[model samples]
Target: MVPEANPRVGQLTTQWQRGKDKIAAALISLVLIVGVVAQAGFAWQVHLNGEEIGVVKDKASLVALIEARTHEVEADKGYEVGLASQVEFRKIVSFSSDDAEAVKETLSEGLEFGLKATAIIVNGTEVAALATLEEAEGLLEQLKSRFIKTSSNLEVEAVRFREDVELEETYCRVEDIVDKDAALNVLLHGSEKLLQHTVARGESLWTIAFKYQLGVSSLKAANPNIKPEVLPIGSKLSLKLDEPFVRVEVVEKQTYNKSIPFATTYTTDSSLWTWDSKVKVAGKAGAQQVTARIVSVNGKEEKRDILSTQITASPTTQVVARGTKTAPSLSTGTFLWPTTGVITSPYGMRWGAMHSGVDIGAPKGTAIKAADSGMVTFSGWNGGYGYMVKIDHGNGTSTLYAHSSKLLVSQSSVVEKGQVIALVGSTGNSYGAHLHFEVHLNGKQVNPLNYFR
Candidate 1:
């Protein structure tokens, strides 16, 4: 200060002070930047319908991962799928970055997919969902064909479902889509589960089989120890019924040759007993070609119509002479009609099996009359005949009345022609209310229709 202030000294001092301040300001800025980097970071938080799933550092990377997951699902399921949940990316400042795999896995767990599928609708109720329409249609076709019985004499006119079956386009959950086979099984079975049946009053093997659309043979096979001739009340029977959910109506035209039955007439002969008769002319069956239109449901015949009948030959009528002098209480050489009804089943080769008796369809409890006067040989429950009555007429002749609801006479009791002996019923292995009538000549079964007048 003494002599004059040195200008260089002053300038150096000023420069030092300015440099110190600059360094301090730089340090402050650096501290501020470090604080910002530590406290906050740019990241993407995944939100599904306002529910946070996960976080990722790079939005584009997360998006790529989600896309990959979608493709993976689509490839595995063999169907196109889309995200069903609401997805949103929120800008967030996270302390640390999240791994791509973790973010994707979390999002995948939270998100749901919508599948494009076809639902099989039966009567407005959805039964099964298939991946494609073609698969649905194929399944329906398979159901229709399941009941078709192919035969050379049949011409399939039409095949359809009884219900309003349709394939509807729909969007379902990813889990709703099923394999073709599974869907088919659902349509085929569909909650119609009837695994067993309990016998009730007036129920027979034929009735049970008809109710479940099962064959009598099949029903017997399912319950090996069951007796079709006697269905005891409250007894359980195993059922093997697998009818489709919707009924399949198969309309077909069948053409085949049928045998025309011969008629038997009588002539008056006062010399013999009323129950005795001698065949003057043997019966010979005529031939006819028949064309019929049949409608079937679930392989069971529902309706049949005879389209045309070409008589190949005229039937030969049998003649028999009976005595008028025989007492009414004893078996005269003549016979009378047992019950008034249509002959349902005839005695002959039926369904490639021998049918030993004629079936007469009548209402239950209808009076069953004796064909001729004879002594009661049997009057009790038979294995297949159910409630039965048998009468023995002299001269190597006997008659049986089967499937009766009640027996009015006992064994060893004598009955005359036109006497009420039993009541009609559908017991045992029978189908409906009917009488199974049989006649034997010389220890051999004969056609009862041929002997009835």
Candidate 2:
């Protein structure tokens, strides 16, 4: 103002003021940018029931971590496990207070937040749930197999679950997810047990089952490969308590043929010896067709019914002839000794019993002669008198030679006096090799010494 405002001084002063204004604007812009950056800062925080669980930069990253933990649990427990899908966020807000690692550590402590899960409902009853429907179905299938029976001739009509299965959303601790296999085992068997049994000598299926308080049918069902009838010694058998969850019924139709045996008949033939026979017809068996219906449950046969029976062929009857021939010999009431031997026991009371005939001692295979024989009546095994030969002497008198080794003549054959009719033998109540001689007059046994010469 004093020097009329020097132009260079005014221009310099204006430049300084403009520079200060530029610096102030730059500082204000920088402060506003810093405030915006601080306000825009974001982090995802997981909370359960208004309680903070963990904080992560991204929600997806937290989910990935939970999945990794689930895989680890699956490997350790040998089952399928996953983070429950029913997890709900109480708050999803920006959280810059902690890093991702600190949040992960806090979640790993399992103190506040829990995993969302699905509940398995069976017929309105809760059972269990997995992370996925496929895994849950797999577990249920395993349970079904435990109750199923195999290797049966019956046809399985259908397999259905006894309960209505459904999946429901729920929440639980991250460690509460059940292992698929173990859960199935616990549901089916109630407890885990493994018992082995070995067969021993004289041990039968019934005995073994009784010893173990088990049923025979259950044993058969458990051991399909072993035969119930022929159980080998030292063979092992698996023992367990059976819990059936499904009813399995099997039906079968069978057809088979059975044989109808033939019958035999005999006719008397007077032309041959007593022991001889001839077959006039041969016997044959017949066939019958049978149809049956069988019903079984859980590999056990429950009922069987025969539908029909048809005779395919008739059986033929067999006819045979038995000989009844006899030899006759004429006599004059006078007789000769049948065999040459010493009389060891005479006809009288012997050993508290009446001796009906004389016992003439002789060697085996000795020749025996008839004493005026008439008709041969009996020849064969006789009670107390073995190999006897009875002859009618035509004059109301008959002669008998017992204990003979062989008979050379047949019945109904004519013979003369003094003929050799039989040989001596030790047969029929005989003490040694001997001949028993007797004579009868009109069916009455008498002394033969009066007629024999």
Candidate 3:
């Protein structure tokens, strides 16, 4: 009778057991999923060098806070600033949220802050710092550009700093950072010290200013009481020195035109004597354009590289015809003007004495040529004629050059017409720089204007 239990009860008990087993499995699965999620980090905590600093919702939130802090520091410092500490992040499972504003406030007040800037360093020493890399580069460019010369004849190709310059991105204190103007001043003048100069005897304003590379007007402007005509001895004068500290190198492409000297060619003919010659073709100078790469430091040229040379015009060689005929005539009997100048003083005798010569006005170093082909009979210093040259032609005429700076021919050298024999000078018995030319006919002094072609 006990084994015959109710069939409905047995069925109900088995169903309840199955329901309980299903609920337990679901609970276990939920616990496992919770455990897995807990293993994965849900939040990030900030650390400084291994010490826990703070926590944030996410990396993006942390970054936003940092940026905001940086801007805040900029507003307060009147310049741009970086975080002072080495920061790192670690993941942790936590549900608590961090106050972003509180973290930023802590950064501004409690933590030491620095500006993230580019520093111009030389030889591992920090020279200056700027807000951005562009500023840094522009500062250096300005430094180099100061040494560049801009002109139609010069094209600046490149500019650079000669020093071993380095731009390092570093986080430095606000006090350590320098403005562009301040940095430039440091590189150019190096100090705020004033310069002064004491005047000595025989030192004029122009000479004193020139010695210090300053303009006379600037010197005068600096000291008002100082007079230009009379500089007092032992006077204290203010001088502003323009001295540079950095070495800036500049590359320039310079274009210049040069003249090519024409060569002379001679040909002999049987009809004329060996001393007789005629110009067949006139000589012409050529022109060439040269392009050179000039390297300079601090406005002083250091090196030059010839890049290209273009011949703009070809030179025409001068051709002259000579004769081999041996005749009794050695002179053409005609003459060319000694030099290209105006006849300043005519041959006369009205100056209480015999002037005896004509004066040709020319530059001091102008070339004086032979009037006619002849043999030089006298060349040296004469009493009133400071360097003198006398040429005797086979005809009855002789030419003389007086008051010359130099004589090219000796006593026996044969000269041709238009040959440079001396330089124009005011050597003896002269009022100014001029060529004292004279002509002698049968040993008698005559007017020199009567014998030129």
Candidate 4:
């Protein structure tokens, strides 16, 4: 009645609706599949300047991957890549008075690189930095910027790199009831290497090499950068020797005692005085006995070979006296006036000020003589004393001859009493040819006339 329509048309419309639903479901499934495939294809890679280094799966592999990449880069660049294990570094820094604490705090924050830092300081001021050598240079720059306002200078003392490699190993079994020691020998001889020694204090490169039956040239060649003429104390030098040498525990203890003489000029009267013998070196334990005579000339010490060392427990101590106990003997004869001169200034207070020494007027180039038997301590232009010569007489007495035209005796040269020491002239703070002479007792200025008679 309601115009009962075509059943075939109705059925066709239902089929069309079902086909559309199927198509929609297929599109959704395809989208999900594409998303999963894309995710699977994703990867993390590192690159420098668009050049791929390597691929890493996740964050956990970052450190190892980076190290590998760096190694690869080093190889390509032909860089001599020092193993991180072998490197050591040190640093020294100075900070201003106000910013010392802040600078220290910044340094304590640790370096960006994975290296250990040990700081040594004096009064909250850092004096030394210890770390790996590779990290030293870069960290130094960073520290410089950080403490630019606080510190004016910084220094690095020693950079060290060392490594040990183990190459091969082998196992051996006893064969047929031979001596156990013989089997041990075979095992030892199969793969053996020499033991090396490091050059230590009081030890020469040649001596160390010779002790180990090694070649001196070989040792020198190994240490190419080290100058043979100027080997620093405690430098590590190489040693060569055949294998199977016994490790000798040679415990040697040496005590060295040295006497040093110090003299100071008296500020009051310009007199020179010598203090008691002071100990220059305290006794210490050493691996071997070292005995040498050191002569100090002009504040410089020259060491000469005295004796070769031997291994001993409680070795005989080396005693070096600064000078002989006997005072320098002199012919107690009246000394003639070094130059025909008139007294320009007396050694005393004048013009409401202290006149340090006696000034004698003479023509320039007058020869000056040593007042007593002693060593020439000073012969140079002093600030206000002009060209000065200080002589040390052994009995805590000394003399100063200043304002000289020429110096005759150099510092530390032994001279006889009345021997020519300098020439009189106007040199420092002088108006004309004159000799300024003063006497000192235990480093305090006294009247030159007290010792003149």
Candidate 5:
């Protein structure tokens, strides 16, 4: 109608319109691609208090990462986050009453927090962040100064990292000293094997062995030359279980000087020398070989060896015979029998036993006298000897009286010759009333017959 609008023109217009629509669609697609590229190229830097810590690529990823980090922090700090933004974050830090009580006391007056702060920059916008609950708690103080209120009872002290720790030093101590070989040697061979006995009246070697839990053979082994059946009472005897040997070697020598004065003089006048003076003498000595013999307890010689000997000092022999030779007075005292009794046993072997001490068979209650002047060293009932008395004469000699029904003297009492010391009886291992008498010299029992007459 409007000048018969050309159909071709109309068709061209429609074509142009379709072309325009296509271009618009292409432009829209290009815009979408640009948006996607921009988003893909978006990057973020994460920092703790301006110190770079990590990076993120896109807005969505950044948000997700921050949320995840916040969750991690919350998990660690046992708290929850409320708001997170580019400028600040708000969180609730919860502490157990038991844990918070101490913190409450320490921070009741307000505490300064040492923050572990993180700054996240996205699209040129800086977002301060705290990743862990501990960081959030630390940031709480800063936020409080900035008028950010938080209901937190968390008081975190500044962390001081250390690579090494100090420890106490220890020292070793010595406890004992050791000499193995010497100790072992002593343990193996240092003990003496011997038996000891104090002689009792009527005790022969046989009776001694019997009383001391040994055999006659053992007693004989200890005492080589002794006849057991005639053992003298009051004698000390040794019974050897084994022979003992010792080795001695001289290790050193020393000398000493000695001056000896031999005589003394008495002067009545102090003038012009009637001279009372003593002569001094010097002595010289040398060394000699010394030998030791190991013997059995029964007096049997087992082994002998020479040890070293050195002169310690010089020796001088000064023999001074001062008394004139005169005949000694003959002893004239009558020897009374110590006990009044019949001689039931003589001083000889009887039946199978050797009679050691003479036995004077007496009725019970017969008085017994000391044979000589001596000190009573023993007054007691000895095994198989009844009651006994031992008198010690000076010079290692002694006498024994046994088989007493009663004792009149105590031990260590002095008695004169012919003093009554006991009443004869059968009080110990005796078959009848009798007095047993024995004699000893230098600790060795000798036959009474040798000295009686």
Candidate 6:
């Protein structure tokens, strides 16, 4: 009835319709897949006391949530908790979010019980921690009482444990709770064990303490029965650790008696002859009672205070008489020994030659003196005489000192009687240290012993 449609046009129309159908089917399939994927499961997140603990997908009941969280918390913290006790649950709905780790961590924190621990501290450092404040304080008191005596005369100024203490809220395990005796032992002696030291020869308590890095008082306190001054050889010494956790300090006042030695005094008498002395009175030691306050730490004295002293018996003072008489000088027709020695050679003729002086053996550097007050005429090296000093007495008398180590006076110097003028030596014509001394009377050599006494 119409013009026959072209075969190519018909084919093109068919292809266009098929492509449109394919695109429609693809859009429908994508919509269905998106709808299925959007559907998600939801659960209630349980929390204790306003804190989120865990989510519940199967059981939405609060009781079931509490039981589950309790068991989980107990297993996580290694401790059990009372069911629904001190616990409040809060539910927060969440979808497609797995918070198992956060829930466990929150439940662990919520189930923990805050514990307060008191610490025994020494020198601002914590030494031990106790369960309760009363226990810690009691331990400190017990340690202080170890050094306190029960005697009526025992006066305690202050008793204290040498450490800083504090109480704080912290987490602790059930096993860490300490008992009374255990706490006391740890508070006093610390965790370190007793170190044994064998006493060696020439080892004293002080040396032992120094070697072990302990106080001498602490060393003595460890062995109360042994004396510190007299230590037995090969004895065992219980040396503890240095700087003990607790130091028991005590102050006491005591009275003791001791002897006071008397002193000697001398009285000079000008009329008494020289080399004469007499004891007028004898001295005797007296007794004194002293009251002192002593402060000791760990049984060792740290400080001492002398309260008062009373003399029980009066001391007898010693009295001695000393002579003050003046000796005669050279101007009084006398001479003194120039030096101290035994005369080895006398002034005489020997070996067919006249020996004009006396030779006295003395040590080198011995002081040589002027026999009498005179003026020095010669002081220098002499032929075969070594260092010599000659003095003119200004009364037709002169003296000579030879063989000296050194000359101390210059020529023309006035010297007093018995004044040091030279030192002994063996300089020339000599084999040893000696002094050849001569006394000349009006140019004639004479025996020096006749002038010296």
The candidate scoring highest on lDDT is 1
Best TM-score among the predictions, by candidate number: 1
Q: Estimate each model's TM-score.
A: 0.49, 0.35, 0.39, 0.29, 0.27, 0.34
After superposition, which runs of candidate 5 have C-alpha atoms over 4 Å from their true positions? Answer: 1-335
Report the C-alpha lDDT of model 4 over 1-453, residue by residue, as the tens digit.
588778799899999999989989998898887676555544444333344333433323444434564466456533323223211111112121223333223322321222233332223433233332333334333332322222222222222111121111111111111232342232223224535466677777767767867677877776677777776776776544334211111111223443333333222211222222433334444344445433322123333444445544442243323433433534343334555577789989999998878888878888888877777767788987899998777666778998898998887678887788889888888787899888887788987776556
Q: Write the residue-wise lDDT of candidate 6 on 87-135 in tens digits.
A: 5443344455445556555555555332456766566666666767777
Q: Which stretches of candidate 4 lie over 4 Å from their true place?
A: 1-336
Score residue 386 of candidate 4 by CA lDDT: 91
1-453: candidate 1 lDDT, tens digit per residue: 479877899899999999999999999998997788655766788888788777877678667766887899899887788887788998876777667687777777876788778998989988888888988888888888988878999899999999999889999988888887887677666664559799999999999999988899989988889889988999999887665668889999998999999999999887765545678788899999899999998788999999999999989999888755423235697777789898899999999999999999999999999999987878999988999998877777888999999999997678988899999998878998999999988779998877755
lDDT of 5 by residue, 1-453 (tens): 459767799899999999999999999999998777565634444333334333433224434545665666557554454322231112222221123233223222221122233322222432223333344334333322332112332222222211111111211111111133332232223344676787888667767777777788877877787666666777778865432122222121222233333333332323221112222333234334333322222122334443434444445543322322221222123335687767677766789887777778888898898877777778988888879998766656677898788999997567887899999888887888888888777666666766657
lDDT of 3 by residue, 261-286 (tens): 99999988887544467788999999
The 10 consecutive residues of candidate 2 with the worst lDDT sum are: 84-93
What's the residue-level lDDT of 96 in candidate 6? 51
Local distance difference test scores for all models: 0.85, 0.70, 0.80, 0.53, 0.53, 0.75
The candidate with the higher lDDT, 1 or 5, is 1
Q: Which ten residues in a row have the lowest lDDT in candidate 5?
A: 169-178
Q: Tens-digit lDDT track for model 2 on 106-198?
A: 665553324456666765866565655567777766655554555433343444554476667766655556778755654544432447799
Better of 2 and 4 by TM-score: 2
* Superposed Cα deviation of residue 94, candidate 2 (Å): 9.6
- Cα miss at 274, model 6 (Å)? 7.9
**Global fold similarity of model 6 (TM-score):** 0.34
Q: Where's the lowest-lDDT run of ten residues in candidate 6?
A: 84-93
Worst 10 residues of 1 by lDDT: 322-331
